[model samples]
Target: MRRRNQVRQSVAVSAALLAALFVLPLLVVAPFRTALFGRETPVDETEGQPFVSGQLDGESALRVLDGETVLEMDLGEYLLGVVRAEMPASFHPEALKAQAVAARTYTLYKLQTGGNHGDAADICTNPTCCQAYIGEERARANWGENAGAYEKKIEEAVAGTDGQVILYGGVPILAVFHSSSAGLTRAAGEVW
Candidate 1:
């Protein structure tokens, strides 16, 4: 009986040590992880309040995924690229304005929500995953003769609607746009 009790106590101690080995690392790293890749917080009840500072400014940078590389660029510059890539510059100015608002809102929403890219980026260039973006050089190549004019137009759209985002229940809406939904809206359950 004495030998059995010793074995059982040793087993319990070993089990506890093994559990600590696994759990201690998690406890130590969790705070750092949260700090590195932001924590999600409930939206404030305040409505139409200006969002803190995820906007296009001298200090702001957006992480963009181009192929396997991630580049950080000025937020305003990034918005110009997104608008040009996502919308036809030939579209009406109001349409461009609406798209700009959506893009800004979407980016801000991602920043607030801890992002979907495994917490690596605030937004991405993949239209399927996040938003579509084209660098200035590519936009020029794609536009040819219209490059300068189209770039200016898109810039204006972004500037005109700067920091504006549509909110539902005090949170930025998903702000997703599709060219055509085959004459039917996608069921929410289907996409999410």
Candidate 2:
């Protein structure tokens, strides 16, 4: 009986030590992980007022290149396509709004700096080159039954922050964004 009790206690201690080996690393890293990748609270500048359209009424149209063709479209209309393609419509309205602003700012920056396509167009539909774009028909097809609702959400997002752009030193900033990062965020100079 004494030998059996000693074996049981030794087994229990071994089990506990194995559990700690697995759990301790998680406990130590959790705080650092949260600090590195915490969610940022977005600021609401609209003061809870409902979004009103027509804010982009007087803006110049955008010249977008689609493959071999150059298409002219209203700035807001183009942003609708960009936002829809760049972000999931299921995202929160505020997130969609932020995407719209970022797309608009990026477009404006490209215009000011003379885009890589030379005189062909202001921007391209290819996401690798510029922002992604999806026509209403294609977007609706992709959304299937949720087409109308999703399009309406994207439209509201674009119209809600119409004409808004991120600026630095009184000029529109690049406002670049990516869906994911490789462990750490890299600066423009580092990537470019």
Instruction: Give me the candidate number with maximum TM-score.
Output: 2
lDDT of 1: 0.75
Q: Which candidate is the best by lDDT?
A: 2
Report the lDDT of model 2 for residue 36. Answer: 67
Compose the digit string of candidate 1's lDDT tens values, residues 1-192. 999999999999999999999999999989899676786443332323322323444356777776788888766667777888888988988899898888878887887887877656667888888888887666766777676677667767877776777999999888878766687896789988
lDDT of each: 0.75, 0.83
Where does candidate 1 clash, by residue pair? none
Query: Candidate 2's residue-wise lDDT over 1-192, tens digit each?
Result: 999999999999999999999999999988899676786434333323332345562366777899999998778878888998999999999999999999989989998999988877888999999999998767777777676778889888898887888999989998889987778897778898
| TM-score for each predicted model, relative to the true structure | 0.64, 0.69
Candidate 2 residue spans exceeding 4 A from truth = 1-53
